[model samples]
Target: MANNDIEVGSRGSLPRKDYFEPLPAPMIDMEELAKWSFYRAIIAEFVATLLFLYVVVLTVIGNKTQTDPIIGGNLCGGVGTLGIAWVFGGMIFVLVYCTAGISGGHINPAVTFGMFLGRKISLIRALLYIIAQCLGALCGCALVKSLQRDRYNHYGGAANQLVDGYSKGTGLAVEIVGTFVLLYTVFSATDPKRNARDSYVPVLAPLPIGFTVFMVHLATIPITGTGINPARSFGAAVIINDKEIWKDHWIFWVGPLIGATIATMYYQYVLRASAVKAIGSFRSTPPTRH
Candidate 1:
């Protein structure tokens, strides 16, 4: 059996290398907490989230004006529900394209939590990012309030609320399913193998991710107002300042976190597996044989 004569075309049935990254041990590396890039990423997350909230909330207000004569602004000239979806989806694409390199463009807390579970980021980093995102969202919504003044209160500030006939259970289900779709797309688009194969299309990753948000909004907007991102929901709820809107607030956080957990487990354990040890492994001894 000469090595060269064995077979060239018959190995196509073999499996490819697993691409999953293992969990990082010590998951709270303080050194990562000390890096300048870490702080820079926090800033990027904050600014990206701020811009995202500002733009999307404004679009919501405009949509409200058209659909509800009581508001009466109609700046979008009756753009309707479809237009709101486009605004959310379009803003996600632009923001992700701009901040993907900086903070992974995780304007959503649920996405950041998903990455954390898959060991794509440290626990501390994830926590900081969530905080920054929440703060940015608040500030963004506050700015909208400042500019819109009277209209801001009248238009609902784009808060997520369960509409008529929808119970708390229904709202929970909507957030879970919507966040799952989004987190799944986030994981797939940013998969190392996918990025490698699609290197020619540098911008392709964020497009599908953004489209996921767009499609989810179209389906869920009339239900729970689409709380795929807990931070987005929280910021709006806070500014809306009505105890009634806050009643179901727990659904947004619980549903999205659960969805993120499920998506991360499915992707890391089932979608891809890899030989590389998880970075930051804290084992007392190496696994190599003597």
Candidate 2:
């Protein structure tokens, strides 16, 4: 077959070329330490994660607590689940858009892990990004506590744990699936193949990614408090410091990392990445003897 996309009745179209050109990120790029841009990227991750956790947790606390005293019940309250989902989604859109050029807009440790697993970022960068994100999350949640100490602890502001009737297994599974959805969207939205093929995808990638986050949150909020981002969960837990909430704390991190791994595998292998091409291709003519 020639070097072009070929059509199969059942398979749609298959491109002979991988069409992905970038070399894998180096495991240890010492030279990156000298680049101010590298540190800037780390800072961007920190600030973005900080803003993300701060805004979202504050919204959660306010929404849950801001009930109508006149009504004298929990019937009509704050923005509700729908609004909370929107905040998570919308904030992600804004944050990703603002810092994409600088830090690739990885506000979540799960996202950073997925990028590193996919070979899109260096190991060093990934480590630093995770550290920055976690620190930022800690600070963001601390800020909320500082302003509303009683409400923060009293209302269970942002701590992630299984609600009543949910098992540890259920919590873990939901986190895995939630993070899988998020990382899958991130990979698809940022794929170079898609960008080169679809003229508009690169410019508006954040929209779909943000929408996915919103959708995931709406699905998982009542069950596990939607802990797709480990950093977000960590920050909230640390600031809230409820002993009961720590029982299932590992679910948030382990689940999301597992989800990220699954998504990476699905994108890189199941969806026909370089690994598929490694099987070799047909030749128009057989090789001649040397």
Clashes of each: 0, 0
Give the residue spans of candidate 2 off by over 4 A.
1-20, 68-74, 279-290
Write model 1 residue lDDT over 17-90, tens digit each, in one string.
Answer: 33332335458889976689889999999999999999999988867776675556544576777888998999
lDDT to native, each model: 0.83, 0.86
Candidate 2 positional error at 260, Å: 0.3
lDDT, candidate 2, 156-226, per-residue tens:
86799889998999989999999999999999898876754655786798898999999999999999989
Error of 1 at 105 (Å): 0.7
**Looking at model 1, which ten-residue stretch has the lowest summed lDDT?**
1-10
Lowest summed lDDT over 10 consecutive residues: which window, candidate 2? 1-10
Top TM-score: which candidate number?
2
Question: What lDDT score is found at residue 185 in candidate 1?
Answer: 92
- The candidate maximizing lDDT is 2
